[model samples]
Target: MNPILSNLRNITLTYAIWLMIGCLLAALLVLTNISLWANALLFAVPSTLVFGSISASAYYVARSLPMKKRSFFVVAGVFGGTALIYGIIWGILCFFWNKITLLFDESWAGIEMNQHLASLLLICGTLLYLLSILVYDVLLALDNIRQAERREAASEMLARDAELQVLRTQINPHFLFNSLNSISALTTIDAAGARDMTIELAQFFRQTLALSEQQKIALSDEIALCNHFLTIEKIRFGKKLQVQMRIDPDSENCLLPPMLLQPLLENAIKHGIRDLVDGGTIELSSKVRAPWLFVAIDNPVDTQPSSAQGTGTGLKNLQARLRSLYGDKSRVEWRIAEQVFRIEITLPLERS
Candidate 1:
């Protein structure tokens, strides 16, 4: 069934209620040669035709109308068309079946007709048709609004999923590349340490297998993963890399993206401190600032412009992760300042 038609039953009920009103009004003022029964039919017939015509025509307009500004011609066209069509239909019914007009009996069995009564019925039919169409348009507008809201929500969900996919892409390869590099570096150093690093690398892969199963972990867990990540880099770089961490007692309990910090730390080691003979400090801090939690990683600047990459794959991946994990509520900034490279992150205290 058409939604507009399904809605028509309610409109019919309204016409019935208003028909009663029309009957009462007729009883008070109009005293004609017709009986009470004929009088009621006259009013009811015109009311139904007018109401149905207006309601259906208005609903059609609403279904077809655009969300943008509407022209006056559209309103006039629907009202005028409904009035003309239902007026003719109701006029035919009233002119043929009217009992009072047929009451002439033998004088003119079916020859005589009440053109005056037909004209009145036509006028009332036209008026009611226009009125009801306007009412139906209002209902159609409401349905359009609801549909728009659903579409908007669907679009937002799609965009977020795309961002998450991008973040996932960044994370997997950034970690893998570093681990692969470590294995390559380890192949020449202590064979026992190389073997151990491979085992930890395997452990990291096992942890990643559950990524789809879990989107978030406690802040402490992210830190632990970073420690493991650093362990691998430590074996490869040996004593040429130094790690410093300062975690706020309060921030450790909050949930963070599952593998967020490890990538940034890995990036810092790979790009900033690895090539230098004298190692540089890499600092990670978690602190609370009123409504926000700030997790920042600062490392020594790679003052020597090293050209060994197509792009910063780690930065791109981190951007996707930030968008997926915290959306607009979180921010990450990477910059080289005062001979130090820093990646500062701000995430909401979302548990509240």
Candidate 2:
């Protein structure tokens, strides 16, 4: 099917405009005394209908001439082919109309059609066909631009997903190595405690495996995962490791990237709590402020320098992930003062 005929509205609009042009051309023929008013009307109507249908074939030609690889030969070939077809159709129609007029009136037999007037009609039809092709070319360009933009957007999304998967994979091994080391030390001196920690460790890993498949989860679920992790750590630290949580109920349902908080919590325990001889408190807090969700973790740090100080990889990874997921709208910041280390993070509040 022709592209123009495939769309009823477009065909209707094109025909209406062409009909107006036909009326104008018919008036010109009459004013120039090339034909009687009645004869001009009879000629213009059929000619316009035939030319309009032929012009619609320009859409197919436009489709063949892509913007990226358009050439002079291809364009010229299309217009040349169209003009030839139009001339053949116009000649045949005019011959039949002339013969019919001669049969109807002996007075028409004396009047021969002017050669200049015939050439003028052919030129007008060819120009109309060229204009139609130009319109289709512009529309084709816009469609190509839209399709290119969609492909770019899809490519970016795939890259982000791959990066996020790599970041998530990095977290598991780091935490697993530390957990296994603690379990190894406890097996000989405290068999029962080690056994209980093993049970909790198994459960924690099961939950982690389930949640890792998701790209994002509710704040409450993330906190629960962190608490499970703390439970396993508490088995190793005993009464020395204390945790304090102040979570806002309203912010519990806010969504964030999965495994986002665990690395921060791990960093606090490794750098701050583990270095202190007494094993100080870790405080976690979360709140919502309109479009933003705020979360903070505070832990007591030893004033004196220790060999167990973090190498900054975890913090850097957290910052990178935050930037990738939320662009510049989300952030992570940390400060150390008065033997206390505080890390604060801000993220856009998105509901599930």
Candidate 3:
């Protein structure tokens, strides 16, 4: 639906309510003996229609006079100009209408066709027209609020997608550099292993390319990608790099941002296992608790910490991605205690 049409449809009930108020005012005039029922109906119905049509000008006025730039003079001018125009138009309409009704009923002609009655009708019509403008102003305010919220939502979505892309791109160069360096080291010692690793690297990149196009994927698919990454690393480390998985069956189908966990696993391998003489164990686990999915990666680190410290770029990138995707609903935490380095991530569990 067109936005303007949709908004008008939503406010139909408000228009109906105001129309009822106009009818009630007409009844009051008849009951109070101020005017006959026929005269009141004729006056009130056309007055209400004119008020409605004139008030529609408020939408255009509102567009011209933005809230940020609105001033007392501007507002006064708009309302005063509107009321003046409405009074002239309404006065002419009431005059002709009264003249026509007087032709039909000579008694009403004498009673209603007077300067005092004309002035009173003109004043009432102007007031009611101003009231209609007020109603329109309120409607304009509400429409502005709705439009602002929509624009904000669109901007947030765009920012999130941009941040996700940046984080994903960051992963490729860093991981490729490490993988190429590993392949360089293995080529002389074990040609067959390097060849296998190269083939695995090609396949892993192909899968990464496919997954990158999606915003979210099943946990099982992510784990499969991680396993492929570990397979390539295992070629270089052999039995030295041991991995254990304790993923809950129920959490497997939960949806998360694509490549979310891969960087954490890479961090564990580079910081915890790569430095050790007898490469330590990497434990991967996942489980769901109602609306939340919990994933943890743990690896044994050297008793004597390395003199070279990690820059923590991967962890920082992952944290940024989590915040962009879920705002405050998701988080990543890391702790190192007793030669065990652990990274835990909590994500909102969404599934199709």
Query: Can you write out model 3's per-residue Cα lDDT over 1-352, one digit (the tens) per residue?
Result: 2223357664585467557756875797777677876667766665565555555555565556677888999888987677767776777776776677667765543235567666766777667667766666777788889999999999989988888888888987888999998899999999999999999999999988888898889999999999999999999989889999999999999999888877778878888898899898999999999899999999999888688778988888888888888889998888889899889999998974
Query: Which lDDT values do the candidates have, in the order given?
Result: 0.70, 0.82, 0.80
User: 141-195, model 1: which lDDT tens digit per residue?
Assistant: 7777898899998998888778777677767786797688778877887788889
Of the candidates numbered 1 and 3, which has the greater TM-score value?
Answer: 3
How displaced is residue 53 in candidate 3, in Å? 4.5
Tell me the spans in candidate 2 whose CA falls farther than 4 Å from its real position. Answer: 1-7, 27-42, 80-84, 87-113
Q: Which candidate gets the maximum lDDT versus the true structure? A: 2
Give the local distance difference test score of model 1: 0.70
lDDT of 2 by residue, 231-319 (tens): 98898899889999999999999999888888888888888888888898999999999889999999998888586556798888888
In model 2, what are the clashing residue pairs, if there are any? none
> TM-score of the candidate numbered 2?
0.87
How would you order the candidates by lDDT, starting with the best?
A: 2, 3, 1
